[model samples]
Target: MISVLFAILTALSNGAASVLQRRAALAVPDTQTMRLSLIGHLLRQKVWLAGIGLVIVAAVCQAVALATGPISVVQPIFVIELPATLLLAGFVMRVRVPRGVWYGVAAVTVGLALGMASAAPGGGSTSVHGAVWVPALIVTGIFEAALITGAMSTRGNPRAALLGLAAACGYSLTAALMKDAMGRLDDGGVTALMTSWQLYATAAAGVGALFLLQNALQAGTLVAVQPMLTLGDALISILYGVTLFGEELRTGWWLLPELVALFLIALGCIELARSPLASGHAAPPRRSTRVT
Candidate 1:
């Protein structure tokens, strides 16, 4: 129960932080590629640096939440930021969110809640099957490379979808690794992320995920990009739990809710497909906000 509470808090913070990052991104002048690179270049303007800093902070909060919670509880809530972000954009940023988008958000939210509620009840645990980190890192790297190559070759919104897929996979891997590392700890709440190969792998995965997501954002609208990323992350994390961690679905009849979740996910994706066309009218005009 405490874990779930922390997870929900983390999810809300993550959502707000993402909206801040997006707002900061909107204020920058460079093209998406250049903006991405420039974010790392401290010599540039404060907004770029601030955006990067805020994203890093948000990520840290997410990691802390995962350290304290079950992946089943944490991952689903983390995924909520996808739809919540769009809603925030609508209300806070003054972006015009579509009615379909709200419906999709509700469906995705309900589906995720149902899915989480249906996760097999247990105290959190993590175990690595083989080498602590080397193999997972290598495989995730290869996967990220393939995803990037595909994203580069693909056209338009499909490329965005592919990138979202890649980002979600990366995030799922990162979460799994983080949970595993956290389980290895005994005393201090903080594990030295540097000492843990799992953490390094997670960091590498995060780099690729962030870059891929940025590219996706460039290719599509915020409403579209965010929801697809969220859904993909949830799906991949669920697979990891079942296939990798040996977590079970709640009932003998688990297939039904799984199917329902898929249906809602598909409907959400359809709504997202129309988002790029809607962006010109959806994005809010630039407003001044301090980045502290």
Candidate 2:
């Protein structure tokens, strides 16, 4: 129950952070996309700094949740971040959320409850061998590189979705590494955490994810990016939980409920994407400066 509460807090923090950061990122010149100069510009924005602070808090909450509960359980709860983002955006943008949007949020909440209750994920290994980490990181890195390359070659919604997926991979890997690092901390204290490569790996992955996410936001509308980002993270996190950590979710008859949950989540995402709050945040691209 404590882990569940932490997971909810993580979702809230992450959702709020996304809106704040994206607002700041969109305010920057579009020419700064995928460039280090973008960070420099964002640093000038207080909203972006606040967003970074929330991200750090979210990371801490996520780590505690992963330490106390199975990844499958903790990760799924993060789907709430979508609705949370919409709600936060409504307040920040001063837009009214429609009745339909509220219905979607209710569906998502109820679906998650049903899914978590039915799936009842079980714990597995807290630590993994170096061999496991090596192959997993290699494969995920290759896939993320492919996604980024594809995104760079495109424009608009497609590019945003591809970059969002790449970011999702990075975020998922970061979560896994964070969990491993926390496990090491438990076993060997601060010294273990300092010595573990997982800690460094988590930080690297987190930076990469942030870069990709900022670019994704710059490339297109939240409607195009947010669902892919949320869904991809959840899917990859599930894979990490089951394959790397050896966690288990109920199968057989429970598969039906899982499918229903997925449907509800998808529907909710679609509805949220159509909300006035999300549309209002879809800023127009800044005019480029041309030099003779």
Candidate 3:
């Protein structure tokens, strides 16, 4: 219950930060590309700094959540982020959230609850065997490399979706690394944690994830990016939780409910992604675009 609360807090912070940070980033001039100097300019934006603060808060909440709960439960709760962002953006932009968006949010909420209940018997430890990290790291690295390479080959929305998935993978890895580092604290106090390489790896994975997210935002609109980011992270995190942390989900007959739950989530995410207000869209003037 504590972990769930913290995870929910993290999701809320993340949703708000996504809107504020991405909006602030969009304010930067088109000439700025991927230059490090862009950091200086972004830092000057009050909105970006505020977003960064929220990000830090989210990180802290996430760490606590991971420390206390199975990764399977904690990470999947982040699926609410998309709907939260949608509603928050709607309020911030002073636009009425469409009825369809509310329905989408309901669907996602119900699906997440169903999925969590279905996966209720999941079991995992706070840490994995050191030997497990080797294969896990190698597989994750190769997968992220493939995603970035594929992203580079694509353009527009496709590029955004690929990059978003890459970011999702990186974030999931960061969570795993953090949990492993937290386990170090349990074994040998702060000294063990400070000495652990998992600590450094967590930071590195987090930075990599943020970089990919920024690139994804730059590559395409929120419509193309949000669902991929939301769904990909939840799905990938489950894989990491199960494979690396030994979390187990019920199978056989239970797989049916899980599949249905996932399908509803995917549907909800896609629907929410198309919301004009959440997407920072100007609410398409279709009649005008049609040469009226």
Compared with the true structure, all predictions reach lDDT values of 0.65, 0.85, 0.87
lDDT by residue for model 2 over 170-216, one digit each (tens)? 88888888888888977899899899999998999899999999999
> Can you write out model 3's per-residue Cα lDDT over 156-190, one digit (the tens) per residue?
99999999999989988988899888878788999
RMSD of each: 5.8, 6.5, 4.9
Misplaced by over 4 Å in model 1 are 25-57, 95-97, 121-124, 127-153, 187-194, 219-228, 269-292
Q: What is the lDDT of residue 206 in candidate 2?
A: 90
Q: Candidate 2 overall Cα lDDT vs. reference?
A: 0.85
Stretches of candidate 2 off by over 4 Å are 18-52, 92-94, 152-154, 281-292
- Highest TM-score, which number? 3
Better of 2 and 3 by lDDT: 3
The alpha-carbon lDDT assigned to residue 96 of candidate 3 equals 74
How big is the positional error of residue 215 in model 1, measured in Å on the Cα after superposition?
3.2
TM-scores across all candidates? 0.74, 0.82, 0.85
Residue 136's lDDT in candidate 1? 51
Q: Which of the two candidates, 1 or 2, achieves a greater TM-score against the reference?
A: 2
